[model samples]
Target chain A: MAEPVHEIEVEIKNVEGLHMRPAMQFVDLAGKFDSDIHVSNEEQSVDAKSIMQMTMLAATCGTKLRIKAEGADAAEAISALQELVEVKMFDETPGK
Target chain B: MEIKKGIAVSPGVAIARAMVIDSKDYRIPRRSILSSERTKEIGRVREAFDNAVAELTELEKDVAAGESQIKDIFAVHIRYLHDASFGKRITDFIENELVTAEYAVSTILREIASHFAGIDDEYISERAADIYDIERRLLTQLLGDVRRGVEHLTEEVVIVAHDLTPTQTAGFNKTFVRGFATEAGGRTSHTAIVARSLGIPAVVALEDVTASITSDSLVIIDGNRGVVIIDPDDDKMAEYEKFSRELTEFEVSLGSLRDKPAVTRDGEEIQLLGNIEFPDEAIMTKDKGGVGIGLYRTEFLYLYGGSEPTEQDHYEAYTEVAHHFEGQPVVIRTMDLGGDKLPYAGRQAPETNPVLGLRSIRYCLQHLSMFKTQLRAILRASVLGDIRVMFPLISNLQELRQAKMILRDVMEDLDEYAVPYNPNIKVGIMVETPSAALTASLLAADCDFFSIGTNDLIQYTLAVDRANEHVVTLYSAADPAIFVLMRSVIHDANKARIDLSVCGEVASEPEYIMLLLGMGVRTLSLAPPMIPEIKQIVRSVTIKECNHLARKVATMDSQRQIKNYLRDAATRILPEAF
Candidate 1:
């Protein structure tokens, strides 16, 4: 069977970058899906499932990133990741 | 026998031995190695350092899960540990120059920590805690050094220290330690928070505490009175024991009244509200029967993290607190950050006289963007529950008018943007400065309510720096001037048909509560724990008696005279409680 493909662009809105904790959370959520997911800024692209890679990108709070997913669950992965980043799931993390 | 006193941050009484935990006791041992083995030793140290860093990193992650505010401190520590100096110079010194591992690490750590400490910024200086934490971790990994060795409490002990850090106090074994007294720290210090959390009594900033008291000597710690009694006689010891028991019973009795209404004996309803600095305090208020939050100090959100919280941050915080009250009013005083509360929201310069310097509403109006952001956030959150906005340190009608003008602009902007908010939200002014109190009649006409902040009002009126020990003696909340100002403000507020409340440390005192009730302060807001006790006092007193006392106090010429009169009346009427 062929893997499905999904892509989306999201603008960063938080005052701080897609820093470690939030990136780690994003990776954690992406890992739940069977799809292969990746995020790309203007200069570079990295696997969305790797927290270290995501952090190294140094995405500022207001920097836009393009999310791409490819697999049987590609559309779901893209939709879920988009919603998390768009709504700033990390900022609303419990007890944070 | 000797006795010392300091500010009572947390209240309780305890009898215990002495346990002195010095920060220096946690130092690491120096490792020595031959030139031939230098490379191997450095390798081992590096590996150990890495492991220690990893452990701290993990621990930090866990702590961050609970408190995100401390994450920056942890991050700075990580950066310092990974700095080229730590790995390069220390490694080179130990490998080539042949310094002992302990000596080299200590030298580097001490130098770096001292450098950071000398930066003159409190936030950067606070990083010393991070360095200290890292050093402890490294020492434990290399030499199996454990500073906090035991957790068992065989006998009662009074912990003495220069200052207790949050981690140190949190790691303390409660059973053995009866109480703690520190030589340095204020009422709002982290050590006080830990003490309160552990249900132990503590006295802070009692200078010479370490020099005066001997270890294992019988001592009494009256945290409520901020007194430390050393080598008390049999009579005094017995009295303290009785007092301790009675206090425990009193606290338990007060706890039972947590759900009761704060009504006078003659059925006069008084609104009991909480003064909160953080959203977490709202839970405490609810637990203590607070009908609402009177003074939600927004300064703490800015002060604690050394950065301005974004509008969303303020909105979420305000929304959570408002929703917690479930329709009960939460009067949030906007960004009272300045003066002594400097180095907050990007103001770092020191002032000669912080009390009279740029602060509160005056500073807010000058910084329109920051001020408007907070106002917008508060207005946006007002729709969640009963939310009222208040301006702090409001002195004159002009300041009041200027503040309301900015608020109008914010509301208009929000309206233009189709933002959801309570359009007719109630506005109020903090009757803190003497000018504000004097012009309360005019100010009250402009605002929806009046909340007298007696802490600053007294400080400003009497020219006393409450934080300065030299002048604190002159700071009196019971001053005749304070009463006159408070009475005039309340009267003006009443005449304007606006709600009047007093939210200050003075309102927590049961004796003062009666006088305020008599002065027509229908709304009383204070710390959560004081609510029940003050409510009990209010329930026991009649309005007529309170009015009589207020009238009598109004005739007093000085603070001392008013205080004496109040003490006498309290002793006569509520002798048992007093």
Candidate 2:
């Protein structure tokens, strides 16, 4: 069977970028589904699971990113990742 | 054999073994490599840098999600990583200058880290810790090495450090870390604040404290007095143990009053309320038997972030407090920012004397948008329970009128929008300045109530900088001027037939409770822990006795006389009660 693919665009509204911890959480959630996920800013593409790659994309607090998910659970993975990226999750960690 | 002393911020005594966690120093390991291997090392270092940046990006996202205050730290880290020096200088030194990859990276990291560390500013120096932590992590990954050393935290150990960053304090494993002592920092420092919040005994700003004691040496730390006793004798240890037990018993006894009403023994009822800065503090207020929240400091909500909080955000916070108190009253103070409490909005420039600067209601009125958002939220939340709105630093009827006008305007707008709200919300002014106290009677007729903020009142009255160490000794709440102001404000509120309260540090001091009660203060709001003690003091004294003392205090010419009278009164009453 051909792998499924899904895409979603989200505008980052938080003042700080999708820095380390949030990316890790997004990756952890993505791992739960059998999906090949990739995230991209306007300039660069990065493997969603690779925290290093995601960070190098340097998505600022207000930067928008296009999330692409492919594989058996691509639809569910896209929905979960979109929600994770959209929600503010790093507000409590001091020195974030 | 030498002793150094600083201001004692928190109270507690503890004896423990000393454990020192120095900020870890990172040095690249020696590796024999040809030109090809050097190239691979550079690639590996690049990967490590990328990984570190990724970790920071994720941290930023988590921080943003939680709406945390320390987002700037991550922003600084991102800047450091992307700096021209990080890649350009190091790469040039390694490839062009023919230096070893490890040597180039180490030299660059040390140079940059030291530059940040050497800065005199505390905020700047704190950034150095972050740089160092990131650098160490990156170097370890590049070298394929692991830190073998593990500093095992023991139950009896007292943590000694140059200073603790907020991250260090938050990451502390409370199970084994019994207490903490620092060589630098004060009561308001993140270290001290975190230690107090975690219920750990800590003494800060003990100069050269790290050099004085070693790991496993028995030491006594008196957090209340800011004293550290090294290698104490058995007699001293035994004495401390006894004192600790007494303290534990005292805390337990106070805790037992959590559910009890704050009514005096003679049936004179007084409202004992909590002054809170966060929603989480509502739990603390309830746990400590606070009848309600007397002052919810709204400035904290506006301070951390750059933009103003949306009406919904303010509404949620106010509603949460109101719901927490249920049927009880929760007085939410409008944004009291200025001077020491600077907010992102309405701060045009630094003032020579911020105490007398344009602040509080004056600043809020100038920035109408910010002010109205807060007012609308407070009014909306008032429908949930007993919610009262307060304006801080009101000096005259004109400022009070202007503020009330803005509040009225916002309510009208909300009405036109058909927004749900309580139109009859009680509005009050904080009698913080001397001008406000002198004119309290006139202002009382215009407002529903008054809460005296003694912190600012004492400072403004005495003309002393409470934050300045050199002049802090003169910043006394017991000063005759402060007492006079308090008397004037309370008397004015009483004459006007409006509710009166003293919501300040003065309300928490056991010795001052009777004096304030005597001064015709029907309500006392303070930190939650202080409520029970003050309540206990109120229960021991009668309204008649308090009124008599009030008369005497009113006639007293000097603070010294008032202090002597109160001390004598406490001595006479405390023994009988015990």
Q: B217-335, model 2: which lDDT tens digit per residue?
A: 67777775677777777777787788788777877876777777776667888889988766777877888788899888776567545556898889888877888888888999997
Q: After superposition, how far is residue B252 of candidate 2 from its true place, in Å?
A: 2.0
Off by over 4 Å in 1: A1-96, B1-3, B7-10, B14-205, B210-221, B229-245, B339-347
DockQ values for all predictions? Answer: 0.02, 0.02
Q: Which regions of candidate 2 fall more than 4 Å away from where they truly are?
A: A1-96, B1-4, B13-238, B304-307, B339-349, B554-561, B575-578
Instruction: Give each candidate's fraction of reference contacts reproduced.
Output: 0.00, 0.00
lDDT of each: 0.74, 0.71
Question: Candidate 2, what DockQ?
Answer: 0.02
Q: Candidate 1, which CAPRI tier?
A: incorrect
lDDT of 2 at A48: 77
Per-candidate iRMS values, in order, are: 9.2, 10.0
